[model samples]
Target: MKIRQLQFFFLAIFFVLILSGCGSSSATKEDKVIKIGATAGPYSDQVTEGIKPLLEDKGYDVEVVEYTDYVQPNLSLDQGDIDANVFQNSLYMKDFAETRGLDIIEAIKVPTAPIAIYSEKHDSIDDVEDGQSIATSNDPVNQARALAMLEDLGWIKLKEGVDPTKASEKDIAEYIKKVEIKPLEPAQLPRAMSDVDYSFVNGNFAISSGLKLNGAVYLEKTPPHYMIGVTVRESDEDAQFVKDIIEAYQSESFKKLNEEDEKYEGYVLPEWMN
Candidate 1:
């Protein structure tokens, strides 16, 4: 009887030890790291230099994973490979998530990459020749935006009742008196400027290619443009670490960085998060 009681007590203690070990391991795993995805450009570089330190001070091990393509970052987030990403805007994020059946959500609006129209052949939009070829981004959303800007500037007219978000070359039922529109990939727009009369390029890509703002005939203003933001899975939206990182990004220090960068002149700014 005495031996059996001792055996039972030892077995209970062994089970308790096992459970405690498992709980400790789980806690360690939960506190491992925070990974963020970004593309290779001002966006990624700025976050690495400006935002990473802020997050680090808040007790997060910040890792900025670099990506080249736009599609992979969201896909990685959906698969739980990354904690967050800082590349896309609300409109583009909505379109991507709906198409891919992902549950990603925006954490905060970062800044806007102004869409601009540049020309090597002409000095300004007014100087564009009749029947001149104008190249724009080939991506559906950006293509629509470029077309809308042209319409806004009175360079072209769209059919009545056409939806601006869904605008495309096919929607141009009536020809603008004398302008030939050509759609090209955003990256290729800068190069196309030498080939075509003008090309609409995103500000980031244009700056990366060493194109000067002084040379651009027209550039989009910051206020009305779609602002880019940090994104995470809907599941992690309320995670404490994620919230801390976002708070750091919206700090006054980051705002000062945006104000001082000459390249960003009137092109981008931190969103007023108040």
Candidate 2:
């Protein structure tokens, strides 16, 4: 009788150990995987080449989800389909969140691509004829930026007291307009150059379309305008994994890759981690 009781107790203990082991295995699988989403171009390339290895070394399984459109990546992140995203800047993200009712926050400022104005009709700003049509982005923030660039170039004068953040063509006070401004979608700006006298193209679209940045008639000044960052849900703001991802992107290896990569040199800089 004593032997049988000991055997029963041992069986019960063994079953409890098996259940505990299963629970631990499930938790480990859940914690090890991290799904990151990014746009399909240079942004995705940078994360894969520059940041993935660091996370893998730290025992995290990093999976990069590639996207083409700007909207889907954030949507995926918000829905918990992705761990995080690194495509847009704070301005774009703010606009997206307000317009879409999202609760995302920036994780780190990575790099900024200078916006440029390209022209097939004119080699330089001096060559642009008075009354010629110049194309700019129609998106509100970018449109304001395009106008600011023009204002800086002495092409037009914005109204006094008009905040740079809230600038619009309607804000132009002077009637001495010599150029016809046409606003178009950011993607279409590059292709519209042949149709218009000049078109302002964002860096990503310009580079992807093979537009040369070096000889552009106008380019956004570097530094502050160069602020682009990774984004995550407000809940993940202080997560250790988020911090690790930021550190990895800001690593020396990644910085070197951004600085020395042939395609990256004139196109982007290594200004990671704000």
Candidate 3:
């Protein structure tokens, strides 16, 4: 009987030791590293130069994983390879998650960027000539905004009442001014500026590729839907760590970084900052 009691006591102590190990492992949530995803441009620059320092100040380790492809960031987020991603706007991400069946949600809005019309061939809009070739993004996710900006500038006209979000070159019911429309990949649009008369280069691409945002021939008004948004898994939306990250992102430090960077000049103000 005494032997049996001794054995049970040892077993109980072993289980207690195992539990203690786990408790220790789970202790101090701040020790966990937060992995953020972004593409190689101003977005990643924000995470590295701004968000990382802020979070690190709050005792959080941050790792900014940079990707060259837009698709990989979402894929990495959905597969739990990343804790969060912040490269896309609400509209683009919404369409991405729906089409790809990824259970991701945009939990916070980041700085927006105007879909700018740039031209190396032409000094200004006044210099534009009829039938000149123009380049814009071919990505379905961003094609509409590019087209919308062109329409807004009185270059083309979409069908009346047609949703700009879904608008494409096919929706061009009228050409306010005659110009050739070329749908090139977003990155290519910037470099192709020398080849095409004008191109709608994404803000980040324009900034990173050495194009001047302030010098754009035309900067369109950014729609609310076009602002960049931070995305996380819907399941992790309420997690305390996620909340901490969001708070850190919305901090004045982050806002200042966005504002100081020409790439983010107009779109870096956090919603709460207003």
Best by TM-score: 3
| Arranged by lDDT, best first | 3, 2, 1
Q: List model 1 lDDT by residue over 35-74, tens digit each.
A: 8898766668668877888888866677899876578999
User: Tens digits of per-residue lDDT for model 3 on 1-274?
Assistant: 9999999999999999999988878865634778999877778887888888878887887899987667899999989888999888888898988999988888888776667788877789777667998888888868988778778778888999989998988899998789998998777877898798888888777777876668888886776688888899999889877888888787877777766766566553545667
Expressed as tens digits, the lDDT of each residue in 46-130 for candidate 2 is 8889899889999999999987556798999999999899777678789889999999998887765678888887888877667
Sorted on TM-score, best first, the list reads 3, 1, 2
**lDDT (Cα) of model 1:** 0.79
lDDT, residue 164, model 2: 69
Each candidate: RMSD: 3.1, 4.2, 2.9
Give the TM-score comparing model 2 with the true structure, all chains together: 0.83
Model 1: lowest-lDDT 10 consecutive positions: 265-274
Question: TM-scores, in order shown?
Answer: 0.86, 0.83, 0.88
* CA lDDT, candidate 1, residue 97: 96
